[model samples]
Target: MKKKNDHGVFAAVRMAAASHRLLTVGTVLCVAASVAVSLLPPLLLARVIDRLTAGLPLSFLAVLLYFGSLALEGVLTSAQESLLVLFGQRMTHALRSEMSRKLSRLPAGTLAEQNPGEVAARFSGDVDTVEALFTSGIISMAADACRIVSIMGVIAVKNTGLALILLLVLPLFAVFTRYVQKRMLAAQLDNRRAVAAVSGQVPETLHNIRTIRALGLEDYMERRYDRCIGDSYAAMERTNFYDAVYSPVVLLLNAVVVGIVMLLSASGNAQLLTLFGMSVGTSVAVINYISRIFAPIESLGMEIQTIQSAMAGVRRIDAFLDQPERTIPPARREAARGDVEFAHVTFGYGERHVLKDFSMTVKQGEQVTLVGRTGAGKSTVFKLLLGLYQPEAGTVTIGGVKVGDITDRERRTCIGCVEQHFSRVPGTVLEQITLGDPQITGEMAKDAAALAGIDAAIRALPEGYDTVCTEGIFSQGEWQLLSIARAAAADPAVLLLDEITANLDAETRPACWRLCAVPPRAARCSLSPIASMRILAAERSRSGAGNNI
Candidate 1:
């Protein structure tokens, strides 16, 4: 079943290549030209040797033709390789783009459950293997197969006895080649596993550096790392042993075949002589062909190894592309408004139900605070409101519209959430606030920053809002303040603050209250503890808004 899926992936790759007809046709032409051009050099060399044997002076044209064939073969071979690389790059680009699009369509649950390292490997490592599958695996194997068959056909025409010998010898060589490749592949996989273990240790050591130092476990860690390295070294040594043995065996076989052909050409029997007899030049060409054949045969073995190794990566990509995707609701134009309501809602992560038959409502212009101990489904409410997950029963609605049906663009303007931690993206300080939303203009960002009480600190920087942000540019508390500015920048109709003050000091805690003063006085606000309901009631009274707890 998995093999069938792999074949489907190959078919998809073929379709991707075919989409670029010009490149595909050019690559085919180059491969064909390279194979035809490769045969000429030895044949031309044979002619040159025959003239010398005849005591005939070689013409400049003959020398030019011989060397010229060699040069043409080199040029064609390079072109073929270059075209394959370009074609592979195009395929990789298309594949990655498709995967990226797939990510957007996948259920949020799928992404949340995925391992960051494994997901990264799909985009980076597995995608690279697919490229190798094209440039080094399949296409290279095809070219080598053509070269080998063409050489065999020539040998059959020129020397039947030698061709007969090759027919018997080649199959045995192929079987031996496959056996060696399989052994090498096993060693290579073991090496990769050991290497991955070694790679993982670096980050683990860094993350636990303080613990290691305090416990005096430095020597223990070093020994573990050393073991991983030793395992990798042993695996590589095994692979190297097979690699070192293969080439010499191939060359020895070439020499033996050449020797046998030479002996048979000088045999006493007329039949053997007729089958193997050749002019001095023909013998030279036949020997050169024998030597040439071994190279492609060796390449075929390696290409087989490459293809087999890449199949694992291909299967991973296939599974990713086949994951169940989220269903997109049709676009809605009406702005989200009115009371925020949760009616008989039930939700959970797998079998662990966080909220069951829960219901709540906060009217417009109302300030609501949910105060409870940890594991009380406070955070789950915000996730449901943000449409990260759909309720298993009933509905969560804003202004009579299902929250799950709200488009992402509308959600940004409709409901603002300040999470416990500020997620820093790669950009300037202003981008951190605006999040590159075109709708959040520069003026709006500045206003929200001022509202969150971070505008003064931002202007103090060398580049002000334009300063390229880096670590330590803002303290932990200031990053939280920046997150508030981000959430409020869109001037959302309702703000959901999920323990935003949990990480903030007393000095920074007051900045969160300014969100209540933002324009649109009717906008509702929901806050979850680390602030007690008593404090929220005080703020509500101070701001002259009805409070709900």
Candidate 2:
């Protein structure tokens, strides 16, 4: 789908600023006040020097004004920093929360198509870049701009000729700025991609650590990671090269202007020394102001580069937010009767159809086992049943009502699934079992674990249900058991198990079968449990063990 290119970096800034306008406005005011106060010290010092040269007594009040301005500038600077830091934190929190909400609403298919590393990079690195713009870069740039303007006004009033010479250099600086700004964002985006590759590699390597070690592939993995780092380093080097060139050029131009003023003053030329009363005191102040004025231009050049990085991040975030969301129209919330059917279903990934004219029916309360080869669409059947995917040419019905009649929320409440691969969630055993469901109690979790024949494994850990169980802590077979236990904890009317015992060893096979013995709830019939397997026996179906396909 075509997306609107509008609302990139500025929209993100507006979103953050909207939440804390008072704080944002206060920070800008402090920056402005600090810049205004800082110009005083240089002006006051010039006055004192002029009086000294005139053979007059130094005014104590002038010195007092200079010192007092310094103090006031320091206070304003501190307040600006403090306010920006607070705003940065608040903005980081709000943006991250918004990204999470957007991710949650996206379609399952869309999420599956995204790379984990890329998503993580956007979430952390991109979000941080935007935060930097808010917390330090934007405010500091504003202050530098104000300082430059105030110093420029003072310089122009003091001597128009000198101001004119200095002003000529600005157009060159503007051209240089435009050139650098154009290249920066593209380079930063490439750098972000390189960094994301690195981010994805680490977790992927960790997940396959056992395989890597078993095959002695450490050097191979290390070389791959080195490639990612090298690309990122090269991207950053290009950006820094622009920064290297811009700062020195501005400094060199400022120095040249200062040299002309000093030489003209020494030559005692009336045109150079007398205009706007450009005496020794005024010359000194002008030289100082040149540095002050040029300093902002240089810093601003760098800040503009940072702003580009933030803009790239905003574009990424906006693209993600624009992706299609899973939408379930309002539908009946009636409970499913546990009778499931797939009528003439046709589905596939892209053009390669996996299921063609498929039909199936399982009576309410009947435990059915679907047996098929790896490519025979058994898993696809379960996906269709669970509403994870829609068939192109058929209807799936649950409880005698079409799946279209059920809301996503209602479907989730009625069905639970245990798939072949288990996600390694970081949490205690109980937390893993309940999966953050507030309605499930510890006792209920333990009961679910017991039904899945995983309760003994849970109790073996030092903290039992409270024991932390992340990746690498559990064997593949044990992890599958935990997945089943989690599905059981949901206590849904229909339970779908797709090759749940595929990873189990011979020793764990018997224990896995006990998972089907979970006591049916009051509204659940005996036929609600459906298991897909790679092999099945006719005797098993006839013995009421499970209906085999």
Local accuracy of candidate 2 as per-residue lDDT tens digits, 1-549: 324543334555577788789987887778778888878877887888899999999888988987888888789878988988888887878778877877887766677777899999889999899888876578788888878888888988987877777678788788989899888777898898899999999999998999999999999999999999999999999888877888888889888888876676676666656653476677777877888888888888888888888878877877776777677657664566556788899999889999999888976555566665567787788777777777899899886777656766666556777788887677798998887777778987888787666789888888888988766667888888888778767566567777666677678865445434333231122122322221221233344332222
The list of candidate 2 runs beyond 4 A from truth reads: 1-15, 214-216, 272-277, 328-331, 400-409, 470-475, 510-549
Give residue 252's error in model 2 in angstroms.
1.0
Per-model TM against the reference:
0.85, 0.87
Candidate-wise lDDT, in order: 0.81, 0.75
Worst 10 residues of 2 by lDDT: 519-528
lDDT of 1 at 247: 80
lDDT of 1 by residue, 131-165 (tens): 99889989899999999999999999989999999
